[model samples]
Target: MTAPLARDTARERSRRRAARRNLRSALLFLSPWIIGFSVFTAWPLLYSAYLSLTDYDVIRDPRFVGLDNYAQLAQDPKVLQSLGNTAFYTLVQIPLYIVVTLALALLLNRAGQRAGLFRTLFFLPKMTPPVAVGILFLLLFNGQNGLVNGALRTVGITGPSWTTDPAWIKPGLILMSLWTVGSSVLILLAALQNVPTELYESARLDGAGFWRQSWSVTLPLISPALFFIVVVNTIAGLQTFDEAYTAFFGAGNTTYSNDAALFYVIYLFQQAFEFLHMGYASAMAWVLFALILVVTGIQLLVSRRLVYYEGGQR
Candidate 1:
């Protein structure tokens, strides 16, 4: 071979060897995350899918049962009831959550540096444990002698029995859920800070007041953040468990209506740990996963029109 041709061939071989070495190094660096995901996330997901098709009680070997568990779920009235309760909680709570958080964000944005202490104080509530929050809910919303009713009585207004009455139970839960909107408030506050000040100035020049500028300028700019919060909260609201379970289903609690507060995850928990229906709970989990996918898809479709991006791309 000619000298120039031999040199070109050698350079090509060296580049190929370097490429292989770089690929190996990259894989080595990523090995930990890859192994963790395989063990913790991917394997569990696949195993759950397999378990969903069987009759396993965490005691004996799983026996193949085909679609029997799903068929039973279809016939279960509690499924519908729990789903309805969860839907109601999500639908009612999300709007109120958005409004309250946005309002707080607006107030904080206006407060400027003076709001530093208030912002920290607002976030402190979110640091409280879920079980403690549930207990606090019972105390604050108690029917006969709670602080809420006491304040209502001072105004000559009768307060409903929040803990006992079925009608008030869900409302009380919703109110309790609102008590931890600190993270959402912080998210919105950050979004508000990112809104271009020039847009507000232009709105003002066009004779727009605070409300008009907010509606036209602020909301559209921060819509992506709002969409994120809505999606996240919707997923969380559907999986409602810890607080409601602590409030109504924990030991020494037989007063609240199960129909009012039996969220989907709580029912799934009952089936798995309480009843040892491991296979059934696995099916329930997959159903929830499917529902979340559908709901999130719908939200994404709706967000195409609602959520505005600065670069005009969703």
Candidate 2:
């Protein structure tokens, strides 16, 4: 009995030692990512939280100010205006973006052997830098001698001043958003191809026509990809800054309607860099983060019903 007990204890000790060795090996492999995340992502996140509670400019140490910045945010008219503009952009752009991308993906999917070439051609626009796109937009929509107006003139219709008119600015931006529909198109196209041909055959056997088959089979199978595109586009639309800033605020131009183009991120940039309101900007950043979190949460809840997963778990 004593001999058997001693052997059991020895085996347990060996297992414990092996487990410790495995843990150390895992830690050694994970060290680079852990260290990088701590320095770059975690530290910035924590420091921003602290900065949001204090007044900090680059020149001086952060002065503790509690909730004063958040209080000011509520009363700031520009904050309200920017939020409204961002909300409008998200609402209008997302549906149009999803429809256009889906339609293009369907068209490309039918191209068979020629699909690759068409995909490359469509994706070329997305490779252009945002600043260059903004400049291109300004040139194309210049109202007087622009290519768009030139074409409109031949058609006996006058194109509105897209850059200068507040009424046309958001619509122009929405149109510009379509220029990068290639990414979503590719995603949907992949999803469309992944859908089993058996499902379509079954639909055809049931006497379903083209529209009926698409509505019943194609949409349900590709619903997950569509949901993904919607959420991503919504987030991007809300954070719209680069193109609007380059077009309207860059090079000290004062002709365009800033109110129409003043997206939430652009205002946040102005507060942080242009005005040196670090604390206020930090607060704005946190508020935007919270808003995005809530919106994403709501989307997740909604997607439980809308998004289809083949494995049966939402």
Candidate 3:
């Protein structure tokens, strides 16, 4: 009995040693990613949360102010205006993007092998730098001599002052967003191509026309991609800043950035850097994070009823 017990103990020890060795090797391989996450992602998130509760400028140590920053956000008219601007942009741009991209995808999908050139042409705009795109848009939408206005003039019509007018600013931004729909077009095109051809054949046999088949068959089958594009564009629209900023706040421009162009992220950037309201900016960041989470959750819930999966499970 003692001999057997000694043998069993030896085997257990060997197993424990091998487990520790494997763990060490695994951790060694994972160390770079683990360290990067801790240093860049996790630490910043934790520090930002802490900073949100305190008043801090680069010049001084953080002083605790509890929830005062958050409370002040409630009374900030600029915050409300920015939020409304972001909401409007998100609501308008997302649907229009979906419609336009989906239409493009459907058109390309029907083009079969001949669509390669068109796809490349469409994707080129997305590869353009945002600042460059903003500059181009500024030139095109110039009130007088811009190409858009020139074309309108050729047609004996007038174009609005897209950059300077508050009413047209959001629409200009929406048009800019539309230009980057190449990614969505590619995604939806892939989904459309993956759709079973037998379904369309059956619809044809049932005497369904183009619109009817598209409604009952194509839309239902591609709903997942549609849902994905909607969520992504909504998030992007809420965080819109670069194009509007580059256009309205570019160098040598004396015109102040009006409320129409003051998106949420841009406002937060102003609070943090321009005004040196670090704590308030951190609070705003947290609020934006929470808003994104809530909006995404709501989308997920709504998608359960609307989106269709091939496997029939949401």
Best-matching candidate per TM-score: 1
Residue 173 displacement (Å), model 3: 1.0
Ordered list by lDDT, greatest first: 1, 2, 3
What digit string (tens of lDDT, one per residue) describes model 3 on residues 1-314? 99999999999999999999999999999999999999999999999999999998868999999999999999999999999999999998988888899989989999999999989988888998899987888888888788888999999999998888899988888977788889899999999999899999999999999999999999999999899989988888888888887887666455634678889898999889888989999999999999999999999999999999988776
Error of 3 at 199 (Å): 0.9
Cα lDDT computed for each candidate against the true fold: 0.93, 0.91, 0.90
Which should have the higher lDDT, number 1 or number 3? 1
Query: Cα deviation of 211 in candidate 1 (Å)?
Result: 1.9
lDDT by residue (1-314, candidate 2, tens digit) is 99999999999999999999999999999999999999999998898899999998878999999999999999999999999989988999999999899999999989877899889988999999999988988888888898888999999999998888898888888888798999889999999999999989999999999999999999989999999999898888879998999999888879877789999999999999988988889999999999999999999999998778998666
Clashing pairs in 2: none
Put down candidate 1 lDDT per residue, 165-190, tens digits, no spaces. 88888888998898899999999999
By summed lDDT, which 10 consecutive residues of candidate 3 come out lowest? 249-258
